[model samples]
Target: MNAVEIQTHARKLYDAHGTKALAEAAQMVRELEQRGEKKLVEDWRRIQSALQQMRGPNVS
Candidate 1:
């Protein structure tokens, strides 16, 4: 998925699963790497981190 799609999907997953969405988002970013799309990997990583942070530190 592109950056926009990744962010959108990540948000949805986050809403449903809370901080667990970080791992799933990371997994998705890795899949994008395997597909050889390096351009947006960093963007997705940042998004994942932000999502995790927004969920708060106590979240697992």
Candidate 2:
């Protein structure tokens, strides 16, 4: 597929599963935090923020 088509399909998949992926990642962050992995938690939060931004401005 062309670049545009690939990007289109990727966005479609992300739109369908982005929230679920974020939730699962957040859960992992929580578990790590509970175990006192503060550094990892911060790293994961950065990843989560990037994903949220990609979802758009209106997202929480």
Candidate 3:
């Protein structure tokens, strides 16, 4: 997905799942990597990064 599409999907995910969306994205990344889905893994990593940016830095 393009940057815009990634951001849009990230926003939708955040809206639907809140902070849990980050975990969901991370899970997807891991699964994709294990499946050898390089392209999808890259996209999901982008989604995960976007989620982190949306959630801001970890406090603890």
Candidate 4:
């Protein structure tokens, strides 16, 4: 997916699942990696990164 698509998906996911969206993306990455789906893994990684950015910086 392109950057716009990735951001859109991340937003929808965050809206639907809140904090769990990141975990869902991470799980997708791991499962895709184990399945040897390089392209999907890459996409999921991008999505995961977008999700992380959505969370903003962590505060102590």
Candidate 5:
């Protein structure tokens, strides 16, 4: 799949399963890494970082 497709799938998986989805997404990223898909991995890292920020403790 292309970057967009991988991103969309990752987002949906993240929403549906929270961090539990990371295993699958990370697997995809690892495959992409092996295939030299740098941009896609960068985008995936951004998405993962965003999700982690969203789940951070609230300061109030």
Candidate 6:
């Protein structure tokens, strides 16, 4: 899949599974980085950062 597709899938997974999905997404992103897919890796990072922001200070 393309970067956008990967990102979309990651977001869906994150929404469905929460923190476990985030961890899996991170691993997927790392694998993409290892494979030299920089754009996809960056997209995943963006998704991850967005998720973090959503959690804010109230999250434990």
Which candidate wins on TM-score?
Answer: 4
Clashing pairs in 6: none
Mark the regions of model 1 whose C-alpha exceeds 4 Å error after superposition. Answer: 1-10
Go through the candidates in order and give each one's C-alpha lDDT.
Answer: 0.75, 0.66, 0.93, 0.93, 0.70, 0.73
Candidate 1 backbone collisions, by pair: none
lDDT score for residue 1 of model 6: 55
* TM-score for each candidate, following the candidate numbering: 0.61, 0.62, 0.89, 0.93, 0.59, 0.66
Measured with C-alpha atoms, the lDDT of residue 15 in candidate 3 is 95
Quality of model 3 by C-alpha lDDT: 0.93
Off by over 4 Å in 5: 1-11, 57-60
Clashing pairs in 4: none
| Per-residue lDDT over 1-60 for candidate 5, one digit per residue giving the tens place of the 0 to 100 score | 555665676678788988677666667678889999998888776656555555677678
Task: Give per-residue CA lDDT, model 2, range 1-60, as digits (tens).
Answer: 444543454455457776685776578689999999987777666666656656677835
* Model 4, total clashes: 0
* lDDT pick, better of 4 and 6: 4
Model 5 TM-score on a 0 to 1 scale: 0.59
In candidate 3, the residue pairs with backbone N, CA or C atoms under 3 Å apart (3 or more residues apart, or in different chains) clash, namely none
Higher-TM-score candidate among 1 and 2?
A: 2
RMSD of 2: 7.8
Cα lDDT of model 4 by residue, 1-60, tens digit: 999999999999899999999999998889999999999899888998999999999999
Per-residue CA lDDT of model 1 for 35-54, tens digit only, reads: 88787777777778668756
